[model samples]
Structures are given as structure tokens and as C-alpha cells.
Target chain A: MKKVIGLWFALVAVALIGMSAVQTEPGLAVGDTAPDFTLRNIDGKMVSLADFPDAKGFIVTFTCNTCPYAVMYEDRLIELHQKMAAKGYPVIAIQPNDPEVQPGDSFEKMQERAKEKGFPFAYLLDEGQEIYPAYGASRTPHVFLLDKSRKVRYIGAIDDNPQDETGVTRRYVEEAVAAMEAGNEPELTFTKAIGCTIKTKKKG
Target chain B: MLKKAIRILGVVGALSLSTFLAAQEEGTPFPFTVYETYADFAPVMAQDNDTTYVINFWATWCKPCVEELPYFDSLHVNVAQKPVKVLLVSLDFRRDLTRKLVPFLAEHPLKPPVAVLLDGKYNDWIDKVSTEWDGAIPATVVYQGGKRIFHGEQFSSYSELTDLLAELKQ
Candidate 1:
């Protein structure tokens, strides 16, 4: 009886470990082919990576309306689109927050924000909150820069400084794009920044 | 007459200054000590004490962070007799220190010590806090002696937090 109970406990422990391993699957890393997505743009039109055929690469940024960090980067994102879009790397902003969880990031609010800021990029909504998780984006304003072939070239923050734009010493995304343009791998592929967690309903 | 007017102005200026200082003293002082760099704040994460340290990385702007804050407070209160300490680390922007954070803290006072980490070079030190952390707010680190655990998500309830502490205590 004691032996049977010990065996049962070991099996339970192994099962729990397996379950946790599956749950903590890491997000897309550098060199991985980013999964193509067709999400809804703020203009009520569906946009996909396929839409930008002339693009050399993409600045696929997972950002939303509500996060203060995301809000701080809005102007910088517009500037990135203006400079990089013409260079064949367009900024594709995606709202990853669930509206039910954070109403401020709803599709309608996104449209309003984009319009107010005169955003020159496509502000897409991850409607079912599916694309972000697939890309393994855990926070708002997370960047997953992809090459023309949809291969992730760099994954991380836009710049070193999140608060003061004038104080920025390292522009991670721009540097990554420049490196790709030069046909060289980004020297710093991964960076981190403090950001709000993507809002989603708590699971049972 | 001109000299007397100058004297009167000086007296008025001094009176207003005293009033301002008095108001500041009477008001609730800003609760958190602001650390400008990760290097300055690194010691808090590396404390090698026998007491269990429950440090929660949070910000005033994060919704989930705000929601889970009460649980940390509850944990602090419940574990008063135990060798456990709870610290709330605020990642609020330094610009908001006077504007948003002070007012928020004034309205909703927390029992635990709150420290504001204003380090913008997150990639430099996020791994130092916890490699499992993806630089998300509300991430928590619970440690005692040589053992440590990092939770990258919000705690659902007070019991959930207590349970983690209980496990760490053993």
C-alpha cells in the first residue's frame, strides 16, 4: 500500500511539471519566422503582412491605447513609420488589450487615438486577443521586428529611454532596421522595457 | 515711502514661504524613496537575509497591478508574526512622481514599504530581478535565504499569495 501511494505521488508530480512546461512556452525569439496575421485596422479594414509586398521588413509593434508607456511611444512610432516605411519597413501597430478587460483600448478608442495623433501607420486590433499570444507578447509596446521574409530580426524595446525622448541614447528598433538594411544582423537583438501587462480576462 | 514699500514686500514673501512650508509638513509625505538607477536599487533584490522578502514590481498606471496590490498588503499584515517582509516597488515614471504617484498614495495608503524604481534601462537589470520576468509590471519575487520564486502574473486572491509564502516558509 505504501509503495502504491509513493508511485501515485511521483506520477502526479511528473504530470504537473509537464503541464507547467507547456504553459510557459517562450515567445518568438530572434531568427524565428514570425507568424503572419490578418487583424482589423482602425479604419474597419482588414490588414495583413501580405498587404505590404514592397516592404523590406516590418516593425511589428504590440502596443495599445491605455498603457502609459505605449502612449509615450506614440509620437516616436509615427516618426519610425515615416522614416522606415519609405525605406520599405513600415510600422504595424497592434492593440493587444481585450476591450472587456480594458475599455480604453477598445477598437473605437484606438481609432480616435490614431486620428488624434495623425498616426501614419496601420493601427490594427487583435480582435480575439489571439495574435499577441501567438507572437508571445506579454506586455504592451513590445516590439517584434521581422524581415521581409517574415523572419523575426529583433525582439524588444524601441529605445533605451522610455520617459524622455531627448534623453534616448540607443534607438533599438531603428538600429535593428539599419542593420537589416546593411545586410547585417542586429548587434542587439533583444532588449527589455517596463510595460503594462496585456489585459485579458482571468482564466478559470 | 519707497523704502517702506520694499520692506512690506519682503515681509509678505517671507510670510508666504512659511505658509507653504507649513502646508508641506502638514500634508502626507511622499511614501516611497525614489531610486534613479537600477544600480542604486539592486541591493533590495539581493538582500541575503533569513527573512522572506516579498517584493512586488508594480506601477500606479498598471490595472492588474493596482488590483493585486491589496493581496500583498494582506500578506504583509497576516505574516506580521512571521519572518516575512513585503515591499511594493513602483515603476512609475519619474515625471509622475509629483503629479500622479503622490496623489494616488495619499488617497490609498498602503501598509508596506513602497520604493519607486525610475530606472529606464530595463534590459540592463530586469534579468537581475528575475530572468523569468519579461519586464512586465506586477511581477513578484518571493525569496528567503538561498531560495527564490518569481511570479510573472497577478495573484488571483489573498490565499493564493499566502499559499506561495507558506510554501516558501517551508
Candidate 2:
């Protein structure tokens, strides 16, 4: 009886530990160092954050072709890159959706979309479904603004109004860059917006 | 000849009126009510009743959300005798009501009350709905009295959904 009770307690302890592990597995938070990665760009070139030696910071946007929320922000992303690239902060767009799950976000479609939109930034693919989980990006169009030291300064949406661009009240990404430029932390370090969940294969 | 022409006109008018009625019944906008702000839609999320409310946040563009929709419908039907309510809150763009959402509903035809919450300010209300949610679609909130549970992932099957409700009842 004593041995059986001990085994039951052991099983309960193991269950508790497993539950905690799953619960605490969250993406990188503010002040955490953004992991540098080498991903395939739409132009068939390998791109990395290290390539931009002179950049003050980066606007790392996790987006894909099929998500409507991502589509709504495509032109805005282009505009953001065009405006912010010269100011030492360039947008690094990464397609995080698995091609097998969402064929529209395949590398070929990504290249086609980039060429059609004339994207001024590096539109890369998160091959093998690796980088996004590391960054803890849960949805498409999720932004992670990193400073010169590759520290995550801000995380979340591009702006307040995702439905209509003209109706936007707060531009979160732009303001974060401006705050970094002024040698101060972003006033709003984090925000949220409704977005399509990042596509991934079901675990067996 | 004049009497014959008048009879033909009346027949034509009657046929057109029936066609119009059929069209109205077929394309009656899916009975979805649109809420422009989260504040306006807060009451639905915070109902203080004994009924178990299963509120799902979804959109037409979200593939997983669309896939799991029938599960919610099935749950609604399965629990018809119980004090449970299933509400589908679409995060679809307000502009897509005519172009996308309504048409999608016309094709799929879910058996639960569907509401369109077009509030763009997600940061403000995401925590209000469930602090555990990260503003992702296919998120479900099941509440009864004061106990609430939030699931941030999709239900793979109808049993998975019913199991959740069963847990909530416990």
C-alpha cells in the first residue's frame, strides 16, 4: 500500500510539471534579445539581421499572403519601409506560414506578391517553421520592433485601426521607431490586433 | 385583345412578386448583427446568467476558424435541452458583410446566432474577453455563472468541444 501511494504521488507530480511546461511556453517578451536568423528572401537570397550593420533597429514583421489582416497591411508595410528605411530602421517582412498548410504563402507566391507590390524591404520565408516560434509570433502581421542591440522594444500591431487606413488613430510601429530615434523607450511597448493565426502542421 | 393583354400583365406581375419574395428569403443577410465597437458588444461577453455561454471569435478568412465552425453548431444542437448558448462572433471586416461574410454564410449556413464584431481596437478588448487570449482567431470562451474557460486553439472535433463543455459543467 505504501509503495502504491508513492507511485500515485509520483504520477501526480509528473502531470503537474508537464502542465506547467505547456503553460509557460510563451514567445519572447520586451527586453528579451531578438534571436538573429538567416532566412530565404523573395529574391532567392539569404538575408539576416547581421547584414544590416549600420541599421539603428529593425521592424520585423511576421506576415503571409493569405491572411486578410496581412493583406490589409501590405501597402502600409511598403509605405512603412519606404519611409523608415532611410531613417536607419528597415522593415524585415517574414512569411511565417507553412507552405504545405497554406499554399498561397508558398515561396513562389511570396515572390510573386513581392514583385507585384514592388516591396522595398526583404520579404523572407521562415523555412522549416523555425523562427516565428522562437520570436513567439502567434499571428500574421505581428510586429516585433528591435533596437540597435537587437533587444525587442515593441511588439504587436502596426496601428490602431486595421479595417480602414484613414481611420487609424495610433501608428504603433512608427511611434516605436521614433521613440528609439529620440533615445527613449517606446511609450506603448505592446499592443494587440485581431489577426489570422499563424499556420502550422498539426503535431502527431 | 385589350382584355387578353391585361390578363398577361397581371400574370407577369404575380410571377415577379413571387420571385422577389423568394430572393428576399434566400438572401436575408444570415441574421448577423454588426457591432462597431467592443464596448457595444461587451454585454454579450459579460452576461450574468446561469446559462453556459460558448462564445467563439472567428472570421471568414481564418481557415481554422471556418473549419471548426460546424463543431460549435454541433455543440449547440447537442446541448439544446441544456441551459447553454453558442454565439459566433465574427471578426470579419465590416466592409466584407456584403461581399464575403454574407456569401460565406449563405454557402455554409451555421445553426447558431452569428454576430459580427467589427471593432478594430483589438488591444483594448482582447484582455477583457480573456487575458489568456493573444488576439488570435478560433479562440473560444466558455462561461457559466462566474466560472469561465478560454481556449486559444481550434477544436479538432465535435467531441473535443463537447468535452470542454462537460469540463465546464463540472
> How far is each candidate from the true structure, as Cα RMSD in Å?
9.3, 7.8
Error of 1 at B93 (Å): 1.3
Best by lDDT: 2
- Candidate 1, position A190, lDDT: 94
Clashing pairs in 2: none
Q: Residue B110: error of model 2 in Å? A: 1.3
User: What lDDT score goes with residue A59 in model 2?
Assistant: 96
Superposition error at A2 for model 2 (Å):
33
Best by DockQ: 1
- Model 2, range A1-204, lDDT digits (tens) per residue? 999999999999999999979877767899999999999999899999999999999999999999988999999999999999999899999999999999999999999999898999999999998999999999988999998889999999999988899999899999989988888989999998788899899977
Residue A142, model 1, lDDT: 98
lDDT of 1 at A186: 93
Fill in the DockQ of model 1.
0.65
Candidate 2 lDDT, B5-65, residue by residue in tens: 9797767656654554455578753457888888999999888988999999998888899
